[model samples]
Target: MAALALFGGIGLSEQKAKETLKNEALSGLLAQAIQQAQDICGSTLDKATGTLLYNAATRLKDQRRLGFLVNYIANKGVSSDLQLNASLDYIKNHPVDPIDTEDFERECGIGVVVTPEQIEEVVEATISKYRNQIMLDRYRFNMGLLMGEARNELKWADGKIIKNEVDLQVLNLLGPKTEADLEKKAKAPKQKAATETTEDKKESEVNGELHIAFERLVGAGSARGGESTNNVPPATATATAPPLMIPSVSLQPTQVSVPNFPADESKGFHTVPITSTIYIEQSDFREVTEKGYKRLTLEQSVGLRHAGYVISVQRVLRNKNGKLVELEATCRKSDMAEKPKAFIHWVSNPLMCELRLYERLFLHKSPEDPSEVPGGFLSDINPNSLVVLGDAMLDVSVRTAKPFDKFQFERVGYFSLDPDSTEQKLVFNRTVMLREDPGKI
Candidate 1:
């Protein structure tokens, strides 16, 4: 049953490898491209992006140049489907397109990564200009204004970062939420923070749950991907509570001096600080002796994201207030000669994000079947279908994504850029998981 509907809700990646596999003409090109993409990102190219491989392989038949362009497109792609389609169309129309061609950057984004400072400057300036309006509207402000101004300045800037910076700056300007604001937010239809806080308060009237919910609402929806688990040890925020982000985070970013790595593994370590000061998700670090945990547990060494190096956690460092503010780990340099058993995705200076984790709207696969679901499809609605992660730390690579841009988050799920995204948050609708769970099947 799971296999049957695996690709059912994939809005953009609907056409999986099977589509190319059935088409012998495109299959070989996809096979070749997938090999390259796997080496680069350890995943298959989004089927939507995979079309370029056919164009590159067929149009510009030079094997070496073909390999280079394919690699570039896989690593750094054009922003939207329209642009990707345009690139594909260009390759088909033109008889040739080498690495030196002017059309590469002109048509698609065959460019460099937009640095954090450059992005920060734009975000800071734009928010300062609209400070009064943003403060007044609070989360109700049309965040797109801030995003539009920033993106106008830097089209290639990570949309994730822009939204994060905007959220951070706005929240900072607004200060803490007043009870009136929370009550008003609670009255709002989808103001996630208010709803979650309300729910937590209901679960336990204790101040601790309220405090945790406040942290979750203010914290990061967060960046990159990391190993996720259901169980975790008790952890607290940093002594300097900059932004109360999530507990599901990996370790903070570190500088790993790797003299060399496999040619295909990385172009270079694009070290972007995911956060300042260290407040790792205790989930990323568990108590020692929890065998097969595969993260930075006590005495266990794990590799850091972006930068490649292993850090063995000697002990957990807490503040005078007993807050889990830092991790004391010993760094040992290592080369990415081959894929390590596990690598941790950490954020040193991460952008704040809101991730809307969606599930099936209706409980029954065939909701319309009265025989399967009593009182019809309407009654089979899944009330807890949407879980909002308001303060998620997100990678900036996804920052400049235009609305409707689709991506498969490494281990999380396939997500679509929902129209609900605003100045306060870049809302993503979870289209589907990477694959179906056997239990659900």
Candidate 2:
């Protein structure tokens, strides 16, 4: 009867029942479309989400701009709403590079960096609570019991970070690595240098960051460039940053390009000596502050991005007339222990240069359209289209960058070497902003 109504047979159904039933062949077309959709996106909603999640994870695997997606996937649980909102947010905040790890993570509720100490405590407690079982099971035991239990308590923390702590705790209890365990580890295939993988890649699931003082409880650390003179007006505030140590002894070149990474960086990258004086932009530090400002003001800490070291400001260095010029700082290696509020990009022995930032030439998107711009297109011309920074500084990583060479300055925008440059001076033009914003420089 319902089918008859759709066939225009509610009143004529008595005579047209046979005719209405004949449309089954047409309905098969609808069925075919559904079958095609199911083939592309799994048959059930659960299967569809699983496929989506897998694709999202795999596609975003090498993408640092996206936060540790494995962590997001593992923790997203069963809430489609949660998954959708988080995914949308990450897309919205996506950058030319990684989401600004400093602010983006905090804003998206990735929460503070779970310090090595905090992780150790949680792992120890979880293990101690189940000590008898761990002793009984040994290698045969479901180690994830420790992992899952600890993860429940620290939901916002990265799994790999937590896994490292768990490994250390379990080993301390289990004592020396048996020849069998060592051989098992040795037999495992090595991954590429660019990718960081664990002895057991299945940390039940999460992957996740930096600094020079390293408290490596276990596992290898990644140290970029042996010696970089790191000056912080920072971005991601690091807490016990991912364990790393720039050898007090420098073996690699002092100034290395970040793009040239993927060499033997275990002892940490090659080093350039820390200059006693490192220049900083005026805005990185603050002399005064208002309420709720979690920055390098009133005792807030910040990290030096990529360098993996934390800078503690002993005194703010200012030039004559009280302008912030530099920082008298002590850099220490991080153990991934404490959460710094922010991290920033800094350069040491940087090259003084000039930068030209560009905005849209017109204030309105459809400047030529009379409806869009009542005034002539000339009247729609934006006055702030060009912003020139004469005091811009660049580090040696890009020293090899010749004219027309393009680079993305993290948290800022994309830039290209300008035609007008001399051996003594360099100038760059902003090719694009990291994102579309009206008044950004």
Cα lDDT computed for each candidate against the true fold = 0.46, 0.43
Q: What is the lDDT of residue 366 in candidate 2?
A: 77
- Across 320-354, the per-residue lDDT of candidate 1 in tens digits comes to 88876555454433342223334544434444657
TM-score of each: 0.38, 0.39
Best by TM-score: 2
Highest lDDT model number: 1
The lowest-lDDT stretch of 10 consecutive residues in candidate 1 is 204-213
Model 2, range 201-234, lDDT digits (tens) per residue?
A: 1111110111122121111111122222122111
Clashes of each: 31, 39
TM-score of candidate 1 versus the correct structure, residues matched by position: 0.38
Candidate 2 TM-score to native: 0.39
Model 2: how far residue 262 lies from native, Å? 11
Among all windows of 10 consecutive residues in model 2, the one with the lowest summed lDDT is 232-241
